[model samples]
Target: MSVDVFTFGLNHTSAPLSVRERVAVPGELLRPALDALRSTWGAAVREAAILSTCNRTEIYCAAEPQVVDQLPAWMAQFHKLESTSLQPHVYRYQQNDAVRHAFRVASGLDSMVLGEPQILGQMKDAVRAANEAGALGTLLHQLFQRTFSVAKEVRSQTAIGANSVSMAAAAVRLAERVFGDLDQANVLFIGAGEMIELCATHFAAAHPRGMMVANRTVERADLLASRFSATTMKLSQLPERLADFDVVVSCTASSLPILGLGMVERASRLRRHRPMVMVDLAVPRDIETEVGRLDDVYLYTVDDLGRMVQTGTDARRAAVVQAEAIIETRVQNFMHWMQKREIVPAIMEMHEASEKVQQAELERARRMLARGVAPEQVLEQLAYGLTQKFMHGPLSALNRSEAGEREQLLELMPQLLPRTERRR
Candidate 1:
């Protein structure tokens, strides 16, 4: 069975947040998930990597053709969901199409926020996890190596990322819409991950009246807070001090909602229904969905921010076109490499067979010499033997073939065989 490149997953465009969150494999679970993927399919899954982020949960694998269609079922089973529940949202690509999809995804062409750079980093992280899990093999390693190269080329050659409205910037804009100016509003950041750090950088530029970082780990929170000259707080302190902030931006890897409706509702009452802006960038969502219903709270999920960032992207359309062109070329190149790889075993077998034929002819020539045969005659016989052996398979095949196949072989024989120079 031939192993081909296969990609299966659902992104923001294909699935809602509700469905996405259910299948999201967090960073901590990535290796285990990859191991599960390989085990479930056994040898059918030769190599695998899972790229799960806030906007997508993609599994890129080098697997047999028969295993491609069953990937969705495996994903649903791993996530403890019914296959039917995920069937409508999932998308699959094979061979060249899969290569193109991977190139587009890494280049940020397939991202929720077009030209966003975060997905590339996330992809790299996923690759690293796959490597550490021993799930990476030659095919996937080469695919991602080319993926990163293509992404770099696209960014340098196109303006896809120029003047890009990042989610961090969008969060600040959302807050300003609620408060008009961040300079007078107190901003609170939840979690100390990269997204939170990015949000802090943007919000810090506004120089909010006060800034604070709350995380499960005080050390991490303190480290992030020092950069923005913000205070650090434990997550336990959020409820008591939640009403103190006018803006809250949260992104965490927690499997469940960190801020529930009851917590935010009480905080809203404590603040006398004062307007507060909240941004939740986590996949499963750090903040409760019902919090958006509160009269005093303005809550935005990752999807909401994705929509907001998509606006005013007309200027980047030309860059997108250029980037896609580059990606398409790279995809073709990668697929060509994969095709060559598929024929390698046949090429090796042919070499081995030829070597065996050469050895047998050499043995025959040595035996003829040992029996006192003429040296020149033995040389001529050796040459003849090699030539005859080389031509035997093709000649036999041509003879066995009927009219149509014989005609095809006759046309191909000249190219397949080496020719001697003709006398001038």
Candidate 2:
């Protein structure tokens, strides 16, 4: 059987964050998961990549059809979850559907925040990880290449990315709701990634009382802090100093929770039960879920931030029809390429046979010329011989074919033969 491209997983829309957090493969674990997936169903799965982000964790692969039956169980087992629990939220796409899904996702069409550009970078990261793990094969590599091209085309040609509220802006909005006036509140960002930088930019406009950036690497944190004239701290200081900030924003690539329930509880205690807003933008989540239950702590995950990012969606929606039209045309073009690629073997065979016929006729003409046949007659006979060779099999098949088969061949003749005025 032919290998087919497939994508399977759950996203923010397909499942709740609680479920997504459980199945999400963090950045560090993507390669391991991809390696396992490639060998999970023996030789069925040929190439694979897993795109895991705050709002989604999806697996894209080239595999045999039967591998579909085994994927859900394998994924659940890899995550150490019950297959039954994971099954209900899973969505699977095959071949063209899978190609379309990858393109839409890279274009930010399927994201929690429509037209969010972060996903494109995240996808590139996944592709890099998969390449590093040697999990990329011809089919998947081509699919992703085209997927990226289509995404670029969509973004460059359409208004899908215009007038959009990003998650960073949303984080700032959410903080405003709790603090009322951010100028008086001290804000601490827990990571120095692009999201944190964007958040810092929005938050700085409020002229907060103080701003601090905490990151695993002090150099990176300092670099970011320098841009905003904020202070920097090591990641380890969060436990003891978390109580000082009134608003906290975190977006990290950490595989495990950095801030646990006890840590947040201590912070709440130190704050004398004063209200504190926490935004956790990590996929596996930098903050513990139990922190959300703390009375004084307003813990918001990426999903919560998603709700606040819907400000200018009407504009994006207006462009959706146009975006879809562009995507559909690209999808058709890609599928047409794939269809032609599938027939390459037959095309090569036809060329090889035609070349052999030409050579054989030339050799016969050489033999006739050596026997002293006239040059004009030899050329004529060679032409006749080559034509006979090309048409003999088709004519013989037509003559021997049954009535129904002959009718089919007759109908196909126009396509198979070159049209001349006489034949027409």
Candidate 3:
């Protein structure tokens, strides 16, 4: 049986942060999660690759119908959730659907912020992790290679990424709405994750008065801070220094809010109600929602940023159309390659049949020559034998037919046989 490429999982689109965070695989646990998936779904999946980012967790697999069909149950078991809880939030794609999904994801169309280029690097990292865990195979490897190529081609050929707003840019835009001029503000970035790094880059362009990176690991914070000529602080010191910076943008993998209402309230009192603009980009938001109610604190969650990011999507709808057109063309190109792959079995079968016929004829001819049959006679017998096998069906059909069918065969044979000999 032939196995088709399959993909299933939830993302920012299908599941809320509540459900998504429960199953979210951290980078450090990716190998273990992949190992668990392999052990649990071994029979169903021939090969597997997983990509789990802040916005999505998707599994790509090569498997049969049974394996593909049972994937949801396996996922539920693996994540230790009720099947119903996971099933509604999951979307499954098989064969070309899976291929197209992979391409679109790599191309950044499926991103929370459309056309963000960071996803490509994230996907590369996921693939590398899966490979390191010994979970990737030829199908997944090829799919990802083609996906990268499609992404590169789309980036080079279309204006999909051009003028697209990034989360970092959106974070800065929201902060500017709170604080008029960033040059007059001290900005604090919490965590040194990729999102924070990107946010720092955009904010640094504004030439903020001061920039500080506070991370759980001081080394990572220092590494990020040096790029912007900023200072680094430990996460524990955030409460003390929180009042010093006017703008705070935080996105971290913390299980709970890093900036609670109490902490912000204390900071607001210390700053003498100077009005702090804070954006919490994390899922389990870094800043508590109640902080928004504080007199001197302005807090925006990921949901708030989502609304801002969606506004400009309308303006870019035309460009999105153009991008979809480009994507469709590339999808068809990838599907064509997949289709050729599907027919390989039939092609191999035809080659094997032809080889069998040739070998049988050769063996008979060799025996004839060994028995002292004339060279020309041996060649004639071989040709007749090969021709008979090749034309057996049409000859048998013509002989069995009585009237009109025989006449049809007689007319079709000359046209069906090649006029020139097929080149060896």
Between 1 and 2, whose lDDT is larger? 1
Sort order, TM-score high to low: 1, 2, 3
Q: Whole-model lDDT for model 3 versus the true structure?
A: 0.83
TM-score, prediction 3: 0.85
lDDT of 3 by residue, 151-173 (tens): 88878877677787877888888
Question: lDDT per residue, candidate 1, 62-105, as tens digits?
Answer: 99999988888988999898988898999999988999999999
- Candidate ranking under lDDT, highest first, comes to 1, 2, 3
Better of 1 and 3 by lDDT: 1
Local accuracy by lDDT, each model:
0.93, 0.88, 0.83
- In model 2, the clashing pairs are none
Per residue, candidate 2 scores C-alpha lDDT tens digits across 297-415 of: 99898888897786558878877787788888888887887788889988999999999999999999999999999999999999899889989988999999999999999999889
User: Which of the numbered candidates is closest to the native, going by highest TM-score?
Assistant: 1
Off by over 4 Å in 2: 41-43, 420-424
For model 3, the stretches where C-alpha displacement exceeds 4 angstroms are 255-257, 260-262, 288-295, 391-424
TM-score per candidate, in order?
0.98, 0.92, 0.85
Point to the candidate with the largest lDDT: 1
Q: What is residue 95's positional error in candidate 3, in angstroms? A: 2.6
Backbone clash pairs for candidate 3 read none
